[model samples]
Target: MKRRALAVTLPLLLMALALLGANALITPARADEADAPALAAVAQAGANTAEWTVEQMDFTSRYPQGFVFTLRATSSGGEIVSARVEWMHRPHTRAKEPISVRRATGEIDPNTGLITATWEPTQSTAVPPWVGVYYRWRLRDAAGNEFVTDEGYAEYADTSRPWQRTETDEVIVFANGLSDEMGDLVAAAMDAQRQKYLDGWGQALPYRPRVILFGDMETWLEWQIGHQDTTGLGIVRVGVTSDEWGGTVQVIYGTEEELAYGTVLHEIEHLYQREFLAGRTVFTPGWFIEGDASFYQLDDVHRVATDYVADLVRRGDLPVLLQGEGPVTFGRNALHGYYLGYKFFEYLDRQWGIAIHRQIMDLLVQNMPFTEAIETATGQSVLELERAWREWLGAPGVVPTLIPTWTPLPFLASPTPMQFGSGK
Candidate 1:
């Protein structure tokens, strides 16, 4: 089956610092603009005990290449000795530290008190266009006095295209080669499912997520820096989410309506999973992860998946639940796991409600085993739960007895890719 998968990776923790408040001013700059400056704050004469002043602060977006930060300051106490720029893609979360705080030492000219830092793209560090970058500067003078500026924010925008943006409290939608109506449709979908997300996950994401839609494959591949093959390893990467970017980056594959309503929401659920369950020592099966994400898709997509899985149940070909390599995650019929997994969640929602869904997720967050968490939340063993779920799907309440041998694959850094939407 040709499928779109979100290849989850353990995000790198590059740097760490004391948490800062969210009240910092955001200054956006486009790369096409000539000499775009962001977050300029002139220091008053008496603002510092060391008589140091910030003359200017600026940021320049270089698009797919990289970005640059420039600082000019004067300190009467002593000549400026060192300067550093620190940035994170998203704000810090109470659940954990910020996804990543990248720090780069700036080249300083002591005579001019000028500092410059440039972040270039590497295979591991490349972020898609329009990802929010929150940053600040730290400076020290020869007198051993240090100063840290208030946080500033900017978008890593691809200014080559005519991009339309729409913002709501829940999400920010950016679309290129598409109408503003496309952005509005995505925003509407997020708004429609806001309450459902809260009910299922118990809270909103720590940061406002982004949905970047590209109208063509070339533009989409431009920012995919290191990975040039869109169809490598026999998987079609229609959409992607990164913990580092804190949003979904997608190329328009199917109809705009389906992309907005189904694929967008499905990718956002993956972000929720990363935020809530990342770094915890918990056993999250591939089926549950992808299935729960699939559950959030709109009814049209849901019905199609439901019909596919229900046919399997009725034919008594249902795969065993929670077993070794429980569901195939790659190659032909990989979507079988996703479709069947959605049914398990559908059973929960129908049998109990979204409250049970939240309860089970809460248990998993506490590092409880998946089986134990589900049993605790629904008061049913794994086998019993499977039987009930099959019955709900118009099948006899008989759990499949086939148990595939579990041959362990080589340990990978990230979990197996959790796939969505089949190309059939």
Candidate 2:
């Protein structure tokens, strides 16, 4: 599947079509309005300082390895004494301080005023292709005057492959070795849930999120440069979402329908949780996190989860939630938690409309205890909520008894693979 020569031609054709329709392209200048003030400040700072005139500035994308930033400037303030480059991922929320910013000192050519800085990917800092980067230069002259350039935006792209991209108000879809129709499906899915996202979270993501789909394993494995190989451990990782990258990186699996309606949407919801809900915090249970993400999936995906969980309810085998590890994320029946968790959110939506979800999340963000937040949102105790949710699932309105046991020894943690199909 990875060796198709058509993959090369298809992306070129799609790129040509995209160029004919300029609106289809994503413009980095359209960063969130919340960032306007900070950007304006940078522009103002650059305007007020006439000491340094930027002769040339450029950024080069060297995917799977690193990128380079170069600047040539002539400073009237005196010979440039120091130079540095700082960059951060885009779509960052302004509600808190930006913590993703990274800095590196540049090697300066004193006579030519040429400054160069390169960022090499490390085990801890590697990011997938298409991750948006906002960078700027800082310079200090011998006269002690300091100047900061306006921010520049660029994507970490792999030029080795012909990639097709599409953008909407909600998402940016990048694909290689996939049909162009897949981009439309993903964009439509995001459009379908845009209102729900706004209603539940009170706002869109501060930045346009990206979905990078790899149609073949070889392409997918290319950018995972420093990561540990888990194929020998029997783990097949289909996809992963990261707040640091501000998007989802997925290896195509199943039909494009499944990828569009379930996998892509499910992973995107994780991005929302990270942006608005603190992202898998200790106070947030795995069931709630994964289930909330599941709620956004459409078509047969939700049906599968509903049916599977309904069977568990009928068999009197519903796992106890909000206790212990709060529905296991791994091990036997690992997906049960995801299915059951979807049921819980489904129950909430059916019982009180989607507003209840926002209420619960609002409380959670306020540092309210999990049980207390749910109780406050639903006006019911944890036990009562559980019983109600079970009853809603066609079970009797009774809380299942839990047998107490001694704490088990801790074990090393492993990565959780994002599985699709079945229940998405």
Q: Find the candidate with the highest lDDT and give its number.
A: 1
lDDT of 2: 0.72
Tens-digit lDDT string for candidate 1 (246-282): 8888888778888888888888888888788765464
Clashing pairs in 1: 1-332
Q: Write the per-residue lDDT of candidate 2 for residues 299-324, one digit (tens) a residue.
A: 57578987898788778887788655
* TM-score of every prediction relative to native: 0.83, 0.83
The 0-to-1 C-alpha lDDT of every candidate, in the order given, reads 0.73, 0.72
Q: Stretches of candidate 2 above 4 Å error?
A: 1-50, 279-282, 401-424
